[model samples]
Target chain A: MKAIVHVGLKPGVLDPQGKAVADTLGRLGFDEVGSARIGKVIELDLTGDLDAAAAEARVREMCETLLANTVIESYRIELQA
Target chain B: MKAIVHVGLKPGVLDPQGKAVADTLGRLGFDEVGSARIGKVIELDLTGDLDAAAAEARVREMCETLLANTVIESYRIELQA
Candidate 1:
């Protein structure tokens, strides 16, 4: 199985990196861009021993415990086999 | 239409953020963690004007021009309505 974890700063939070990217885009001629919020993608290839839900739960725990700062960021997990 | 752009550091490139996260995870008891590679995800809700491929192309251009550095990162685009 393979899983992808997408983590990002929640709306209304300050994101300096995202702001910098948006600024760079404006300079590059994409003036219509309103905003940019940057985040992280963590992809993992796992063995097939665990059921999808179990694996997802494990991943969720990983995110809550270590992968993301739940106070300022949120994460979504996608499972692929 | 809605689109998602996932950008990440390419393998073999140095990923200090990923390393830092992995180190943090290990300290937090996820010793099974092998490696961590950090990236970014951009989700956009768009109007219904452009076709999926066209929007994807625009996003790819954006990634190349602003969202990602071709030297160290690669991107994937997903479209939804």
Candidate 2:
């Protein structure tokens, strides 16, 4: 099975990297762009007989413990068999 | 409009960060994990009257020119109104 996680800053959190990108885009002639935010995607390959529910639960644990800060960031997970 | 871009290393590319994550997960007792890969998600807010197709095309250009390093990374773009 495969687990895909998308972790991003929570709303109202400041994102300097994203701000830089947006500013650069404006200078580069992409005037349509108003803002930008950057985040992380982690893909994990698992080898086990666990069912979908168990896998998702385990992955969520991983997020809370190691993968995400949880205070200023939020994460979403997707699983594939 | 909003554009979401997911950028990831190509299949054959080596990802040191992902390897470190996998190793750490193993040490942290996630023995089921076989491997991991890390990627980026960039969200952009756009202000324009352009249609969906046009917005997508413009964002693709942004990816090609600045957002993604096409030599080693591949990117997918999603648009939302």
Candidate 3:
């Protein structure tokens, strides 16, 4: 099974890296771009004989414990068989 | 419109960051975890009057030119209206 986690900053948080990308895009002539926000996607491969529900729960715990800094960031997890 | 880009290392590329995550997970007792790979998710807000097709094409160009390191990374773009 696999767990795909998307971790992103909260809406009100400042994202310097994203701003830099947007600025670079503007300089590159991608004038249509207004803003860019960068985040992380962590993919985990699981080997145990866990069911979908169990995997989702385990992955959620992983996200809370290490994958995401919940104070300023939010994460969404998707599980696949 | 918005474009969500997922950038990840191509298979066989050495990902030390990912290795570190896996090692940490094991230390934290997430024994089911076999491997962990980290990537980037970049969300871009588009302001111009571009149709769906045009937006996708434009985003693809951005990926090829700047957003992705084509030599060792792959990117997938998703556009949302």
Local accuracy of candidate 2 as per-residue lDDT tens digits, B1-81? 999999999999999999999999999999999999999999999997989999999999999989999999999999999
User: Each predicted complex: what DockQ?
Assistant: 0.42, 0.90, 0.90
Judging by TM-score against the true structure, name the best candidate.
Answer: 2
Models sorted by TM-score, best on top: 2, 3, 1
For B1-81, candidate 3 gives per-residue lDDT tens digits of 999999999999999999999999999999999999999999999997999999999999999989999999999989899
Residue B64 error, candidate 1, Å: 2.0
Q: How many backbone overlaps does candidate 1 show?
A: 0
Query: By lDDT, is 1 or 2 better?
Result: 2
User: What interface RMSD does each of the candidate structures achieve?
Assistant: 3.2, 0.6, 0.7
Can you give the TM-score per candidate against the true fold?
Answer: 0.77, 0.98, 0.97
Error of 2 at A69 (Å): 0.5
Q: Candidate 3: where are CA atoms >4 Å away?
A: none
Considering TM-score, which of the candidate structures 1 and 2 is the better prediction for this target? 2
Could you give me the TM-score of model 1 versus the true structure? 0.77
